[model samples]
Target: MKKSLVILITILLSAVIYGCSSSSEAENADNNTEDKPTLTLGQTNWTSTIVPTQIVKQILEDMGYNVEVQDAELGAVYTGLSTADVDIFMDSWSPQQDQYMEEYSDSIERISASYEDAGAGMVVPEYMEDINDVGDLKGREDIVNNEILAISEADPAMEDLQDIIDAYDLDMEMVNSSEGAMLAAAEAKIEEQEPVVLYGWEPHSMFQQLDLKILTNEKVPEIYGDTSIHVTVQNGLQEKAPEAYNFLSNWSISIDDMTEMITKIDDGQNSEDVAQTWIENNQDEIDNMKSN
Candidate 1:
């Protein structure tokens, strides 16, 4: 009977020890998960936006973060950031996006300028020497088939283009299309050395692939103000992911480097691979970004 009692106590103690060990292991796993919070980054499909977002994504993942990328239109991207449905947005064109910023000012924070010399407006091939200004397109509707190739109508730049058309009384139609389609159209036109009017911005590979010029418009300086690309985030991102926030706050890339990475991406290279190559070559810059 004493032996039986001893055996029973041994079994109970063994069971208790096993249970405590399992519970401790489970708690450790939960703590590890809590320590590495999943970060969701908002991205637009534009190549300029994709390159930097992917670079930042890889950097954060290297820092032991579980990163999620959500691609959406500009409006939806902004809305997601504002509501904290998304944590970071790498590309926010200022002044042009000022209205959205104003609307979501209370929820979104502009982290830093990614690049400062970005320009957006009507662009024409250099061959079209006469088409140097928005007003220049007024009489050359036939050359462009009475069309102004542009991106989605949801874009604020599209609205600005419409206003420019009405303001200049250009007999041109704003043909709405995707960025890919617009660039394809512009490419086809450029190959033939033909004249085409399309929306253009810096930090894009097109400027490197083709000889193009951004047309000026004196009538709407406000719309075409000195454009600067910014990195924006949800209001709580700084406190929620301080490491990621610090990396982004110190992030800035040259127009030349961004354009080169964009060209690589446009040429069928994987964006992450392109980013990795850039990161490898730019360790000093990357280190600076993470210093604080």
Candidate 2:
């Protein structure tokens, strides 16, 4: 009897100790997970960046991460990424933005291509049937005459674009305005079938909402060539948030997809609703990009 009682007591004690250890380990794990650092993202006024930024924010939150976004200027975004004030910047246009990148290349790193072939160029409503290319614009200047080429607020890339205009000695006026203002002007002009030329790029609401054509510029060199945009992150972001970085590195959306999103937003659909709709509809794309 004494022997049986001692064996039973020993087994009970061992089980209690084991259960405590397992419980302690689980508690520690929960605590460690709760301690993970929050991620910070930076966004500019560009819709191309804005839409993706929101998508990324949603994904990070789903991954149990704390994410914050700051609306900043182009220069400020680059500086923030370089200095690690921001963890990631979803909109970095290359070659055109080469000057800014070169200045901070040492501190900032290019994570991946967000959306390639995005940049500023002249675009006309599809109704302007004769103006098919950049060369054609010179002949039909009157139709597009006094029609200012709207541009986003002062950005270094805009400066490079202006240089191209000067080099080509193009007679059109480049109107300096906010992205919102430019879009509003473009919208009004398109509504009336009035001819206008404006700085345009992909992943924009205008592209989806309007039937337009991008005027081809032959004078632009091929190497510096086709315009493209990239996704850039702070120098230590990968090491800091490997999961978020991986999602961003693989994340990409087509001009058509972005255009549709922008169009929905412009047409009075709430941005959050539009974003949720996109996320739910494109689960496969998001899953492939976000998978380990």
Candidate 3:
């Protein structure tokens, strides 16, 4: 009887020790997760980057990560990342941005390709189907009021548009304004069912908010081709925030999908609401991306 009691006591002691170890390990893991630094993302003033960056911020926050976005000039934001002031950005337009990245190759690392293809052009609502390419704008002075609604005068898109205008000998004059002005003008024209042309690109929410079509530029096909967009992180992001880095590494998004998310925001839905809505709908897919 004493032998049996001794064996039972041994079994109970082993069980208690194992349970304590498991609980202690779990608590340590939880504390490690909570110790991760708050992530800061940087985006340029370009509107397309705003919505998508917000989506990432919201997702990270939803997963219990603290995140914030800093919107600044293109150069400033890139330089910020190079200095490790920013954690990550997923809105880079490559080929255009490649040379800039080259400058910071040592400090910043291209962790993953977020988008495989990108394009830009003069865009009009789908109703303007009667007009096909950039050259078509040459003769349609009355419809467009001899104006090409453009982003800020400092934007590279303005220079590119000027090149197209000169190449096509377009009669339309470039009206440089803020992205907000361009979108507002496009919105008014869209509401009136009138023809309007604005400098636009793929992966922007504007495409989602309006039934728009990109005008082909046969003469300048070299200017806008399929550019790879990537998620860039400061050096050692993986070591600093392994889980967050891992989640961002595999978060691939198509232009169309980004467009949908952006459109929801452009339509005045709160960015957090839109991101949360997307996360709720795609929980399974997001989980798959984060899975080991």
Clashes in model 3: which pairs?
none
Tens-digit per-residue lDDT, 1-292, candidate 3: 9999999999999999999999999999888668867889998766567766877887787677778788787777788898888888877777667766899888988878878868788888999877878877777767888888988776655666788888988788888888888889889988999889888887787776777888888887766667677888888789988888888888877777777777777767887787777778878878877774
Candidate 2 structure quality by residue, lDDT tens digits, 148-223: 5666646765676566565556676677788888878888888999998887776676765777777777776442
* Per-model TM-score versus the true fold: 0.87, 0.83, 0.77
* Tens digits of lDDT, candidate 1, 108-143: 989889889688888988888877878777776888
| Winner of 1 and 3 under lDDT | 1
Candidate 1: residue 31 lDDT (0-100): 85
Clashes of 3: 0
lDDT of model 3 at residue 80? 86
Pairs of residues clashing in candidate 2: 222-225
Candidate 2: C-alpha lDDT: 0.77
